[model samples]
Every structure is written in C-alpha cells, then in structure tokens.
Target: MPDETLVDVWGLAPAVLVIMVGGLALGLVVAAVDRAVVSGEAGRAVVEPLLAGARGLVEQRRTTLAPDRLLWRIGCAAVPTLALLSLAVVPVGGRTLWSTSADLVWFNAMEALLWAAVWLVGWGPNAVHALTGGYRFLAQGLAYELPLMFALITAGLAAGSLRTTDVVAAQEGLWFVVTMPVAFVVFVAGAAAFAFWGPFAAPAAADIAGGVTSELSGVDRLLVDLGRAVFLGAAAAMAVALFLGGDAGPWLPGPLWFLLKTLAVVTALVWAGRRVPVLRPDRTVEVGWMVLVPLTLLQALAVAVLVLNGFYA
Candidate 1:
C-alpha cells in the first residue's frame, strides 16, 4: 500500500523477503493448478502439494555411487536461487528490488545462469539417464532461447528502455500485446520450455526415467521441483508485466491489480499447457527454429515500426 512508484532502498530487505515468499506461494498455486488439471480432482490440488512437501521433508536422501555431491547440491540450490534473483528486477508494486538501467538484461542473465545450473544437476548424478536428460535440456534450450530473447527484446524495443517499469508505463495507452501478440505467446511458451513444464518437459520425460530428476531424492528433489514451479510462476508474472499492462486496471489498488493479473496468467498457462502432448527434444528444436524464430522476428520488426512512427506517443 505504500507508494510503490518510489524506490525504497532502506526497505530493500523486506522487499526481497516479500518477493521470495510471494514467489513460493505462486509456485504452490502453479502446482495446484497442474495437479487439478491432471487428476481432475479440484480438492486434491490444494492438499497434495502441501502433503508432498511434508513428505519430502522427511524422506531419506537417495544416494548414488560416485555422484558429484558438491555440484549436485549446488545445482539443486541454484534452481530456486536463480529464480528469485530473476525476480529482483520485476516490479512487484511498481518498484523493483534494485533499479538497474538494464533490468531486462539482468532477468535474462539469471535465466542463462539457470541453464547451466540445470545441466550441472544432470551431470552431477553421474547416471546415464540423468546425463541424457541434462543434455536434452540443453538441446531444448538451443531451440527456445533465441525466440525468448526476441520476445523480451520486443517489449524492451517498444518501451525504448530496458527497465521493466518503463515498459509497464509505455502500456498506458496500449498494451504491447495488441501490437505484439506473437511475442506474448512465444514469451509465455518459452517460459514453460525453460522450466520444462507441460509440453516442453522432454528433459524430465518418463522415457528417460524422470530425466534430470532420475537420481534426486528427498530435499534435493523437492528443491528442483519447487524451483521449476517457481520459475514458471515468475515467468507468468513477467508476462503480465511485459504485455498485460501491469497494475493498470481500473479502480483497483495497483498491487492488488498486479496480483490478480499474475494469478490469472499462471492459471491460464497451466491449464493451456497441460493439454499439449509433450514434444520430443528434437522436434521441439524443429518447431523452435522453423516456426517460432521467424514469427518472433517478424513481431519485433512490426513493433519497431510502430515505435518509429510514434504510435506509442
């Protein structure tokens, strides 16, 4: 409720805490939605995630011979750590934790770090399946990463600044989605791909024996799974911030509006993504290069023209 438009350096600690807690809460929401969709039991959605977390807390760690313990633990911890770090540049209530001139780049950098973290997770287990899964993730990344970059860059181009707050402000007259719908769709789909959720889950597919998570157990498993969910949730919030005019709804308090829009995005993403059959990693690459790359580039070009014509003004 405090003026979110003002950057409060003194309140930075609390802001970080809030983002962490809220991010985790959103993760839970994402889990619940996916559960409900998969099982067709609305009641189980809320109860199952909590029960799973509780079970994970007490479960014994699964061990493998010759595993890279240091890298494994570091990779597990970094999943959620990088997700939270990416949120630092996102405007929770019209103010970011740190105001950087290139907030968009900061967020993208965290995502790139996450790519390495996930590969490390796959390699640390030393199991053939785990390594395969890790490599699959890398392959999928090669497919989705460029289109995702263009999607983010498209938003930054329209705003004429890489700062997220400025991007949100530029939507005062028209949400970028109107001019850049392909970027919006590609952006959200890219989030699911990077998180390995729904259709883009080839890296963690059953064919590979749970893939990167094949050897994980107890707290390690929990961290990786929780990290995936949190990353998806954060991406949904970002989609809203980038394309839906963050906190710009009529008559509602800004933070509340932002929260509502974010929840809607997370729910919709889960519901829609769940129905698509998971693609093989190779085919995912085909679609990424053959379909998405060209589409997103064209979307960016159109936006650039709009920017040049002063349509935003």
Candidate 2:
C-alpha cells in the first residue's frame, strides 16, 4: 500500500464506475445475507435478490393521485445517488476515489442529506401512509444522527485527522475497536437506522402499509431498497476502515483482507439485525437521546484522553 494519503491515481470516470458497480454489488450481497438469515435457506438467499431485481425491472410503477412528480422522482433517484457519493472518501485498496482533509465529515454530510431525501420520498406521494412514513423517518433521524456523528468524530480524534486513511494508519498497532467499542456499536447501529433497515426500519415498517414505500412500486421501490442495502454495506466497509483497522491483516494482500473484513461485518449486521424485533420510532428516539447520546460522548471523551496521553503515539 502507498504511504501517501489521497492518491487520485484512478481518475474521475473510473472512480465513479467503481463506486457505482461496487456499491450495487455489495448491496446484492447484503440482500442475500439478510434473506439467508431470515429464511434459514442459503439457496433462496442466492436466488431471491436477483429474482426480485428482475421483477422490479419489469413491473409497472404505481403512482398515487396528486403526487408531486418532481420531488418524488428526485427523492427516489437521490437515495442511491447519495449512497454512492458517500463512498468517495472511503478507502479501498488503501486508496479512496477522492480524499479530502475532512473525509469523515464528507461521509457524514452524505448521510445527513440522505435523511432529507428519505423524508422527500415519504412526502412526495401525497398519500397519508407515505407522508406518515416520511415524518417517522424524520423523527428517527433526530434520534440517531448525533450519536453517529460523535462516533465518526471519535475515530478522527484518535487519528488526529479527519482523513479516512489517517484513521486506518493510526490503527496500525491497535484497532480502535479495542478502546472505542461503544463508538463502533453506535456507528453500525446508526448506519442501520439511517438506512431504515432491520430493527431501525420503522420508517418503512409494514404496519403503516410499508411506510415510506407505501406509494412506491417497480423501479422506484427497487431504487429505495437498493440504496438501503448499499448504504449498509458502505457503512460496514467504513466501519472496517474506522474501527477494525482497514486492510491490516498479515499475509493476504490489503484489498483481499479488506474484502474479507467487510463481508464479516455485513454478515454480522444482517444476522444480528434479523434477531432483534423492530423498534418503534418514539422509543428509539428516547433511547438515542437518553442512552446513546451520552454513551457516545463519553466514548469520544475517553478517546480524547487516550490521545492526550499519547496512547496512540
């Protein structure tokens, strides 16, 4: 791996292709894992997601009366767009598509934008169920977003830089997960919440007729679901970079090790998410503010203290 940070060796076009194709592929993997976990049928897991995508491609799109066509379309498109965009700063093969001094902030910004995009999806349809879902997502975002930020900041604080590569490099000797496990847990949980996935899926829960997805069908539905899976995979990869020590295994090459770790994280997320019952948005918000906010803050403070003592030095 190169020692220099933010190597732009792969130009813009290639980077975009990598992020697009790689993200979609990872999203499929997430779907498969989730299916296997829930159905206890490994074979079905392999076939279901592909079949679902094909069906989505061929199915007719459903539309509600009095829909805001423009916002609905934009919101649908933005879900996957933002997911790929967020990956620009994530290091792969010891390099990122694009790197900034505040790579962590860049990632966080994309997630924040996703919060709005989801609300738009819920609001665009002009249906009571969809609008309710949108509001639910908004409420959910209020609860989880801050702790997520603190978790990201804790990694940056330990690295003494906001760059993703720097965070990985800082973990050369000790993975941040060892000392900042709370941040790791919160970060992954936040990712699941932001994606409206698993236990944090109140925004799209079935009791409200699929919530934000109530008014969507065909490709629109496909896009939102695809975006959620990809975002979860991206978060797992980012978690690897931030806490598990990006590509730091001994014998295998860096990229392969990174792939392996990412797969493990994805599997763990899906397996665990399946077992926990879906949480109500109101209760989730309460926990986020009352329990998670303080826990992540203390996690950040502890990392800061460790950094001051040159524990990372």
The residue pairs in collision within model 1 are none
Best by lDDT: 2
Position 261, candidate 2: lDDT: 96
Off by over 4 Å in 2: 1-7
Reference-based lDDT, residue 250, model 2? 92
Q: What tens digits encode model 2's per-residue C-alpha lDDT throughout 1-313?
A: 3344333566667767877899888899999999899889897897899898888899999888989989998999899889988877888777887777789999999999998899889999999889899999999999999999999999999999998988999999999999999999999999999999999999899899999999898999899998998899899999999999999999999989999999999999998898888899999999999999999999999999999999998
Across residues 50-132, which tens digit of lDDT does each residue of candidate 1 receive? 88888779999988889999998999999989988787777866787776789889989988898899998999989999999
Q: What TM-score quantifies how close candidate 1 is to the native fold?
A: 0.96
Give, for candidate 1, the lowest lDDT window spanning 10 residues.
1-10
The lDDT of model 1 is 0.89
lDDT of each: 0.89, 0.91
lDDT of 1 at 233: 86
